[model samples]
Target chain A: MDDVLRQGVEIRLTVNGRKHREVVEPRLLLADFLRQRLGLTGTHLGCEQGVCGSCTVVVDGETMRSCLLFAAQMDGSGVETIEGLADDPDRLHPVQQAFWDHHGLQCGFCTPGMVLTAKALLEENPEPSGAEIREALAGNICRCTGYVFIVDSVKAAAETMASNAPRGESP
Target chain B: MKPAAFAYCAPRTLEEAISLLDEHGYDAKLLAGGQSLVPLMNLRLARPTVLVDINRVDGLAFVESGDEVVRIGAMTRHHTVATSSEIRGASPLLSHAAGHIGYRAIRHRGTLGGSLAHADPASELPCVAVTQSATVRVTGSAGERTIRADELFLAEMTTTLAPDEIVTSVAIPRIRPDEGWGFREFVRKVGDFAVVMAAALLRVADGRVASARLGLGGAEGTPRRVTEAEQALVGSVLGAETIEKAARVAAEAVEPTSDIHGSADYRRRLVHAMTRRALQDALGRLEAGHG
Candidate 1:
């Protein structure tokens, strides 16, 4: 057996474009590493189980369920959360801005993950169709707004991002 | 739901993974995406003293398409398989089933090899593997071998995998151009485990069925091939009587066990209705020339 696991292990993860290294238990989930270890609690943990997507984050530009990955699994990996999307104080990621403008959230428990999922989706496809948007965010479950506003927000964001991008570039 | 304390080892090579599994035997468990395993661990339903994390094992994340077989690496993410153009061309049924597993988050992290090895009767991948005639490749210290998909799954949440072995890849053989595929499941939610699921792949040649394969999940302790149904589908045309007979045979072959999601009788009904619908869907695809 590894000695570090018996004691603890040093886990280094790049989150929101920044590098973070810490010692955590083997059972520490990636969600807790962002929330408890790094004080980035914006990423909510609704269902500790994998059903709800509230704990979703982008790992190496791919969306993953943070609750399902152990912190150690992300060693030397790049993690992007909801906080990483907005660099400027006044500006949000197109997906995030679209959510606010379109009233995409009510209780807001599912917003961060929804925005992250949308950002990841639009990053790959700038002009996603309605059905594509539905499929892209199918993992995210929202209680309020009946998911109409959220889907609309992803569509609006996709359009805005599409219009903003240069030709021949991926969304 | 915090899991109990345990040792975790992220072996960097497949050799090390096999060695660790051999050393610990049943005391250790291989941790993949942790989508299914973590839930069990959190509930203390499964508590192992050691966890062999093979996420970093090199060359275990790929989708390989040979001239006739499409081999997916054991650790390949479901998202990768779902979006794989190669898989779309080679075995679209697998790509479709992978997409239908849970949701995006789960798909992004979950693995096909791990899911098939887990052999959960309610999961879609096992049924898909069986329906499509996939071959599961197992690697251990002894040697590498392959198990027919229909023979891979043993029981609920169990498989024929030895404690010392690791599932390395799943090879899905090519589908004839004339074959069509369809899958149907009755789950409470979009991503919930199925109460009853049926998948079909059949080839219509010479105005008659040339080959037929099916996998029924949640209808048996293990996802199994419906030999009785296959016998009926053979040499039949895409007609009402053929479908009815095949559906009845498929339903009768079912050895369903009841649970909270449904009763045995309800599942039996689903077996017939779902089999009929899935067969119709595959037939429609054949007619459209989109196989």
Candidate 2:
């Protein structure tokens, strides 16, 4: 037990296709590791407790609450955040484009998480009904748009991606 | 909301993890999925000095089907449990119940062993374990032992596990061809904790109830089997009148406490309604010959 009380533990992992190595305190959350250490503030933190989906990020192809995970836990994992979605500022990802076209966001505090969640959903399911879109985004809370436009945005994204339009990540 | 400073060790084997727990005793908390414990730590409600992370531990995440039972590793995530074809075939009730826990993100990280060891009464896995009479297997420095799910939970957020013991896996009996099951819960939102949840299992023989098991959560400090209601269903035709009697008995038997989510009276009414609906669902399944 005495050996366990080290000041820092070294971790090596990939974030958005980039490899990183760092020594971090065990108490540092994955959310803080991304926002503070990597300067990737795209992932927002609302309720740090898992209730709010504002801190959502894709780890190894599944969406997880970054706030609930420790930085050390990402030692050998692959993480995908909102910052990794589109390679170009001029051309948004299909999901992001759909959100813009449909006016899916108002305050935009919850948009990053919402977009990533929609990306994961569309990658797995190319054709989703409005109810399915709602169910998939249930974890992501959008207090501004009342979720009607958000649902429409995800639905349109699914259609655009399914139609074989020139896409960025195939999602 | 940062957690308090704590030493961390990600053990690669079960033996190393148990030794760490044995050495640290109550000062250490096992970190499986960190769904519940991390939140408590963030709020400063639980401040453990050592975090024994067992995510890297070998051979703890699996779902193995046997001739008579299905063995699920402790570290098996809720999403795996809900989506596993083996689990869905062997115990569809467990699979269905697992799918309803929290949300997709929570399901991806939350584990079966963590949920049971946390011992939240409103949680789905605990109620399913108690209803199906699953056996939890735990290991410590001393040795290994098995505990019935009925005796595992002591109270809300409490269990019979020793400070040095770690849950390894659970064994649940496979559903028989003649058995039917139904699960129902009331929640305020899509992924909120259930206000009241009910599960019903019935075995019909010759158009009559041969055996019955009913379990309820959020009605007491621990999820428990309603023996009186179960007894009332036995030897009776599973008709509307008989099901209503059992539901009423179930509603009257439990002592529920009020919370911000619901009142005790409201939970009682939920128990009655959920029980009736669950039993009706079970009967319908049985009639459809899937039981």
Candidate 3:
């Protein structure tokens, strides 16, 4: 029992292209660790249970609910948060810029997660249909903007990314 | 809401995980995808003093097709099952049911073993396993063993697994070449738990139903294989009359409880309708050359 139990676990992981090492309590969620310990607050926490997708982060290339995962579980995994989306500080990622152009956010609580989800969707599917976009973002809940604008924003982002791709690389 | 403070141990091997479980007994809960268990912990519905994290366990996340079964590792994610070509080719019913689990993020992180071990009556995978007659393999300090799906689930959110046992994998019998399947559920929202769900498989030979399997979820304390309904379809030609009779039998086969989402009577009606629709759907697939 002594070997199996620990007061705190030390985790070493990469977040948004940066390596981090921290010792955290076993119950501290990954969402809180990113916001409090690392001071990356772009990841929002809504409905700390797994219901809301506001705390979604790309862990090992798959979007997962950060609120449900303990910080200790991310020992060696690579995580991507909304803060890492931009290729440059002066420009937003195509997904984020599309949201800005199309008015995809209102109260802004669900924007970061919605943007990251759309980014993953477009990265995998450069030309997603309206229904496909809706299905991809269904886990994320938005109380404002009525979701019509978000769908349009994802569509716009897909178009921008397809056009930006180099000739034969475009899908 | 936050989970209570607890000790966490990430075991890199199955043997080590079993040993940890042996030491902690009921005080520890194995963490798979953490989609279900963490939510319960956050809400304070579950308060284990130790969490044995098995995500790092090697050789526990795979999908393989063998002579008679499609073997899925317990740690296989729902998204992987939903998207796997092998699973779709071997057992289209299981593949289709996996797609109906929670939304994309949940599917990306939730594991089939976690869902089955949780044994939520309203969940899709347990009912699919019961209808498909799958087998779950478990390991404990006493070594490894297998339990049939029918005997695995004992009650609501409870299974026959001992406290020190850990489910290792699930083996689903490959769908026979002559079988057709259908799955249907009535949910208020796309990701909400099913009010009543049905999965039906029919084996046709000589224009008659050679065998049938029917299962209903969210209609009782545990997902049940509706033998009476299945028996009503065997040897029949699957005509409208036979389908209606089986639907009625399915509606009468279980005693459902009323919750805020629905009444027992309403669920019974859903069972009848879903059964009829599922039978029709199965027949359509058979006619469309699912064989």
Question: Where in model 2 is the C-alpha error above 4 Å?
Answer: A1-6, A165-171
Question: After best superposition, candidate 1 residue B69: deviation in angstroms?
Answer: 1.5
Q: Taking the tens digit of each residue's C-alpha lDDT, what string does model 1 give over B172-265?
A: 8777678888888887767778889888898887899988887788888888889899989998777778988999988888878998888888
Give the range where candidate 1 chain A is weakest over 10 consecutive residues by summed lDDT: A1-10
DockQ of 1: 0.55
lDDT of each: 0.85, 0.92, 0.91
Residue A150: error of model 2 in Å? Answer: 0.4
Candidate 1: the clashing residue pairs are A123-A171
- Candidate scoring better on DockQ of 1 and 2: 2
Docking class of 1: medium
The prediction achieving the highest DockQ against the true structure is 2
lDDT of 2 by residue, A5-114 (tens): 55798999999999999999899999999999999999999998998898999999999999999998889999999999999988899999999999999999999999
lDDT: worst 10-residue window of model 1 chain B: B185-194
DockQ measured for candidate 2 = 0.69
| Clash totals for all candidate models | 1, 0, 0
Error of 2 at B35 (Å): 0.6
lDDT of 3 by residue, B1-291 (tens): 899778888899999999999998998899999888999999999988889999989988999999899999999999999999999888899999999998888899899999999999999999999999999999999989999998999999999999888888999999977888999999877777889999999999899999999999998889988999999899999888999999999999879978898999999999999899889899988988844
Candidate 1 local lDDT, A69-164, one digit each (tens) = 888778899999888888996998788889999999999999988898888788888888888887777778898888888888898888888778
DockQ of 3: 0.65
